[model samples]
Target: MNAFNEISKSTAAFFVQAGASFGVSFLGAIGGIYFLPLDPWQRLFLGMTVLFLVASSFTLAKVIRDQQEASTIRVRLDEARMEKLLAEHNPFSAA
Candidate 1:
């Protein structure tokens, strides 16, 4: 169990670091391309940039959705706990 926990933590940290690095480098590339001369090469780079942005946007949306679901679950758990406490406080309240 200890080894599993450590491995999980390390893997999560690695992804976090990788994501940050990728984000920064991706932004830098997009910025650099803006100053490139307008030619077939520049157009190709722009097309690729748009594709990357679209793909990342889709991925981010899915992450947001999963997070939203998790948040809802937490909210429901808290509500259940609160109700349990309330019932304990008032047996006749018909909670």
Candidate 2:
């Protein structure tokens, strides 16, 4: 386990693949909206909704990661305190 950051980092290839996938999916959604037989107003609305969904998804991901990191830090602190307490005590020693 890494002392600095308990969580492992994603690989560069994973990042590249994720970026490419996001780009392709976003473009595909926009293209689909463009080629739809619906009215221009409807297409525009759908595109705006999709954009909002993407933004919200990113926000949610950030919040979840932050919460996870906070919990991990809390657990690490608790563990350190427990270790210190244990190190200071000995059953064989007279009180």
Candidate 3:
């Protein structure tokens, strides 16, 4: 149950971050189209730049998220190792 809750929370957070990043990128593209006065080639360049930025943002977010999740897993493993060591050290328990 706790694991399910954690999964749901992480999934929700991921979607929220993705949605927000996409929304901002879209708005930025729209704003650029409306506000920038440029030639055809310039507009094309701007469009490509915006696309690259959006893609980069998503990739960066995923990388950071994976790093954080890995860190959490490492911490949990360390905790379990410590617990096992403590158990082994207990004089009252039969080995």
Question: Which candidate should be chosen as best, given TM-score against the real structure?
Answer: 2
Candidate 1, residue 79: how far the Cα is off, in Å: 0.4
Per-residue lDDT tens digits for candidate 2, residues 59-86, read: 9999999998898889989999999999
**Per-residue lDDT of 1-95 in model 1, one digit per residue for the tens?**
65434543547688899889878877777767776778878768796977788699879989997897688678978998999988779656666
TM-score of each: 0.47, 0.88, 0.71
Best candidate according to lDDT? 2
Worst 10 residues of 3 by lDDT: 1-10
Instruction: Give the runs in model 1 whose Cα sits over 4 Å from its true position.
Output: 1-38, 89-95
Whole-model Cα lDDT of every candidate shown, in order = 0.77, 0.93, 0.81
Sorting all predicted structures by TM-score, with the top scorer first, yields: 2, 3, 1
Error of 1 at 78 (Å): 0.6
What local lDDT does model 3 show for residue 78? 100
**True-vs-predicted CA distance for residue 16, candidate 2, Å:** 0.6
Tens-place lDDT digits, model 3, residues 1-95? 66734663757688899889878869977687757888878888888888788789779989998898788889988998999998879788777
C-alpha lDDT of residue 43 in model 1: 68
